[model samples]
Target: MSFLNTLNLTGKDKSVGLLLGLILLSHTERTGAKDKSNVVQKGKGSTAKLKEIMIGRCFNYLGTINPNAGNKDCSKLWEAFLRAFSEKDPCKITKEDYKPFLNMADHDIPIGQSIFWSQTKELILQYTDVTHKVMPLENTLIGFMLDGLNWCGKLSSPGPNYEACPEWNSCTNHSMGSFWRAASENYAMKAQGEVTVLLNGSANAFRENSIFREIELGKLDSKRVTSVHLWIMDNIDGPDKESCGVGSVAVLENILKEKKIKYTCVDNYKPVKMLQCVFKLDRPSCNTGT
Candidate 1:
């Protein structure tokens, strides 16, 4: 009575207030349960943003490089890419998962225009960009669109997750590595005629499990690929670790013989050396103008 007297609330008014309170409590509980069911991890970058960049690159590739790969529906291609790993365990994604996406984005490589590289990534990119006479996996649409990006999915999220992804070695079948394996295999299979392989003359050159070794080299059709031209490049300064017919390079040569793929090897192929010199003129080794 004393509490009701303060605001003069009647019995009916009290009942109405009780009902409203119950409604609010029920709404709050429902909202909480809904949020709990929608578990998600925000990736470091937006999946939408990745889609934007990828699709833009897709249109650019068709416009500039492979107009012959006609009528590509980029939206559909992106869907295929998403379907590869959506709602799947990041650690379980296999190379086979990406087959649909790869098949959608495939384009032919010109004869003698395929380039494979290991341990010489930047120089090889420079050569491809400067010369525009060859194509590497990174230059092809399947590789180009996704090269620098990292993405993964979660059981809680239907698509790419945010805030975190397992490191490359976190699992044997992590999404990115598997995708690249499929891409490398497709690239190698598409290659025809002589293929140029750029190797680091200062390192093992052919790392035992590198994509170039496991996927690209093995998938290369001996019937299609005539010879492999290995460009063993070392820094202009020093620290030459291995070169043609020596060390890891020799091991690769033996494998090539077993496969019966004719090959040639060169130390610091002049064109690449010249390209390297262009940006590193301060080095005496690059100062060849005499």
Candidate 2:
């Protein structure tokens, strides 16, 4: 099916798409005032500052953050990461810690619970499964409200049409998929110029899309991407082994290599396996146009 058709465009879908489309178009139209547009803004931490948070704390704290894992230091790191997200300040965290904290805040936190600041904190503490809890790296359910979700922004639900799924748990990773959808949706909304969506039956989804190659050629604009975060939510047999599920870091690594992108793996900030790998796409990758 064509991309538009594949979107499952019903009347409601079209209307929603148009609304988002208008928002995006408005940002692009102001290209003349690009220097001053607040629609997008740079993240607070530098590459070096981010590195300190990730390698120093996030990786080190791993299992402990799960609360159920019985690791005191880990719990501390988890709390720190959660706080960084809620505060939008990475003073204590390093590069590694930023991705998961930001991702969870961006995609995983429920929109309804986002209203009250205390409520957001409560949800993070509640969902953490120290033993096997799949805490979100991003609050993917909030859709276009990612910017609004930032602690600095006006906090509220996206709209009346937007609500947390009632049967979220019964639906595939439950709320996890919602988080992914939100991240992907946020990216599409923030992108300027052309944004292409592709699906491949091939195991190498990245290759089929030439995502890395396109980025290198500058055909894929960097300002739109912000940062790329991934989660490997699976019961893999072992480390360096297939999880029987797709989207493994090994696959992403190979694609990055093929495209010759200069990427550094952020360490320490979050659960390595659960939060998995995060990549900083050279310059302007994480700008996300604010």
- Each model's TM-score, in the order given? 0.82, 0.21
Residues 1-290, model 2: lDDT tens digits: 64446566778788777677678778877753642322223332122333244334433333333223232343343344444323221122233434454344332222112111111232233334332333233222222222222221101222111112223233232222333333343333333322222112122333423422233223323443333332222211212222212443356555545544433332211343232222432323223351
User: Each candidate: what lDDT?
Assistant: 0.83, 0.32
How much is the lDDT of residue 81 in candidate 2?
44
Cand. 2 Cα-lDDT? 0.32
- CA-only RMSD, every prediction: 8.3, 22.5
User: What TM-score does candidate 1 get on C-alpha atoms?
Assistant: 0.82
Which parts of model 1 have CA positions greater than 4 angstroms off?
Answer: 1-48
